[model samples]
Target: MTDHYDAIVVGTGFAGAFFLLRYLQHAPPKARVLVLERGRNDCKVWQLRNRRTSSLNTEEFFINNNPEKEWLMSLGFGGSSNTWWGGVARMMPGDFQLQSRYGVGTDWPLRYEDLETYYGDAEVIMAVSGPADSPMPRSRPFPLRPHRFSDTDALLKKTFPDGWFHPATTRASAPTGTRGICCGAGICELCPHDANFSISNGLRRLHDDPRVTLRLQATVEQVETSGDLARGVSYTSDGQLRRATADLVVLAASALFNPHILLRSGITHELLGKRLHEQMPVDVCLNLRGVKGYNGSTIISGNGYLFYEGEHRRQHAACLIETWNSPFNYRRAALRAERGRWTERAFFRFMFDDLPRADNKVTVNAANPHLPEVTFNGYSDYAQRGVDRIPAMVDTLAKALPIEEIESIEVARSTSHIQGTVVMGNDPATSVVDRYLMHHRIRNLLVLGSSAYPTASPAYPTLTLSALSLWAADHLFTRSA
Candidate 1:
């Protein structure tokens, strides 16, 4: 017996969710759609368990790079959307034209205008909370008004005074479906309510959809291709080998996994696994004089993007700074014991824009082709210049605000914003995919996620990736017909 569908989607994270939503909206009612996810659907179990214990990174996936460094991702039905602190920022318009505007990196094939409408669509679906006025130009306002600044955030605003705005977040201030109003528990990594947007909120509807069929805990091993067309995909479930045929295949797996699957299928283009990179997250710890930070939101409350894009890009990579609203509770007691003083502490995170390099990439080991071999070229001098800008920013804030001593600055070992392994562009020779995210060589196969990003834009990649997925789905289904 053979199983077949009009289309098949792999992974169920940010990219996959939006792709499926848009595809279903456009596909004929009777068109069959199959979704394969390697992780189990157990959001309730995980949510309950997380409340009892501090959730750790999943060990099911591994990389050949530094063992101490963890990739900020989750292996579950909803993917990282279930685990990540939900801060979604739209890319600055200049981000789309980096190469042309600043001669710093590869230019995205599509401009911000091309995806502006889809960005608005994603914001509504995710229930984003953001200020009416933002530094970045927009076609429309966010769906919900921005949350009020927590006491801690208000103090920071008074301190810095410039380039600040309420961040766009997925945590709801009102009920949307089964999601409840956020109580500001400050442990948002494991949001107790469905307040933070996660595909788990709509998992039931997707599973119940007549056009959709879901296969959980099914690990895809190969993309079956014949001649120039993608035939389907091969996978293993419960230790049994199975194959599903489809006219089109969409890969929304992580940047590392996407290339591994393509390599297994023997579509080994040189650009397939090259130019992998992630933003460097620099953590700054401040012992404040007059504020408490632990009582409000646990993740971000506001962001500063003054250096996100400017003429300075000719000398340095752009940078975005975000203020953490949660207090330093994890280390507060320990630090108090060591220093013998009670004090309020705050954390500020700086994310430097990353540039792509040919030397940085993902590859498959000959001995074990199933596993991924990740090589990071590390940060460039341009990025280091961005890191160097932080102290001046701190100095400016300190001079204008209350007395605060900078206790420490810690550079994070890892980040969730992985990108550029399978980049998109107009030239087939220099890129893996086209503007629609379709493989230059294999037209029936499309890849989504930050993997399609030509450069690591100086903003959170979730919203842009979601928009790109919808754009690709709309073009693929509507135009193909």
Candidate 2:
């Protein structure tokens, strides 16, 4: 007994969701699509039981790294989007042209304009909200209106005047109708109120579609390929090996897993696991004596952008000053910095975008389990530069508001949005996928997600990734038709 489909998409994250939805909507009527998800399908149960479980606990990130530390990631229907805080934002035009604007990285083969329409469509599907005019050039109006600011956010806006410019409120992928307000379940774990939108919702819609079939708890072990064409994928499910064949194969398992899968399949292209990009998040916590309502509210409210100027001659870096106050977490983070420090009152988490450097990369560990290994380089210089810019940006905010003292600051690895491995380009020698997201070596294979991003931008990568997936689907459909 063998399973066959017209298309098979791997991974059920944002990229996978977009690909599944677009193919069902636009693929030839007779084309059958099968989505292969390595995780389970229970979003609520996974969120409730394993919400606190660290993503690094599994073989994905923990194999060669330290065993004690727990990384955060959800392996379920929605993928990481299930636990995501749902900060939907578009990349600035400058992000798309980083190579031309600055000599750091390669420019995207496709311009921002080329994907503008798809971005609009993705916004509708995700139900994102933002002001009519955003800062990005050639921007279009959002499908849904902007989300209103909370009471705490309004106070922060009034208190922080300089350097802090409150652009339109960032959008989330949550449900739009009745259940819009966030219950503030510390979205880092899970959205208990169902206010957040993950790919699980999209999967539910396609459950009955005869053209689509979803296989769960099926870990793809090998991609059987003849030369450059992938014939099918072999996997282990229910303690048994199974294989599925498809005319077209899409790798949407994100930057980390996508490269790992390719490496395991023995496709060692020069750029398979190189050029990793991560948006480094830095936290700046302050103790404001008179501020209330900090603990019980949404963590992030508004952000500010500062273009790097003068002698550095580097591309501009953007920083987000998010309003957050969790007494326990803040105190714990503070104590970790300098033992026996009690942090009370308001706090600000400043997330900064570091320019993507080519040195940072992902590789498979040959000796131990062949799991994913990430080596992040070039952060020392960026950290030193952050020390200078962070306080300056804070000082600009202190002028408008009253602050008892700037308590403590810390930087943490951002698991929310990671991009750039298997980047898209016009030339196959320099990139894994071509302009249409088709692998130059394998005509029937496609690579989707922020992995196709040439540079990591300050904004959240989900909306942009969704739009790119739609664009790729369109190209696939046109070529197949």
Compared with the true structure, all predictions reach lDDT values of: 0.79, 0.66
lDDT of 2 by residue, 1-481 (tens): 3587788888888888888888888876777777888777775655567654223234554342433222346665667876676676667666677667766556889888888888878877766656554556544676555444444455555664333333332224234663355545444445566666666653467646877788887777767789878897888789998888989888888887788888888877887877776666666767554444343434444444433222232623555555553444523543223333343345666655565566667787767544677666544355346545777776765665556677677665453576787888888788888987888888888888888777666677888888888888888768745
Give the Cα error of residue 114 in candidate 2, in Å: 2.0
Error of 1 at 63 (Å): 2.4
The CA root-mean-square deviation of candidate 1, after full C-alpha superposition on the true structure, stands at 2.6
- Return the TM-score for each candidate structure: 0.93, 0.85
Clashes of 1: 0
Residue 145 miss distance in model 1 (angstroms) = 2.2
Query: Relative to the unseen true structure, what is the C-alpha lDDT of residue 133 in candidate 1, on a scale of 0 to 100?
Result: 74
**Which runs in model 1 stand beyond 4 Å of their true positions?**
50-57, 155-162, 294-298, 328-343
Which run of 10 residues does model 1 get worst, by summed lDDT? Answer: 329-338
Query: Can you give the lDDT of residue 273 in candidate 1?
Result: 87
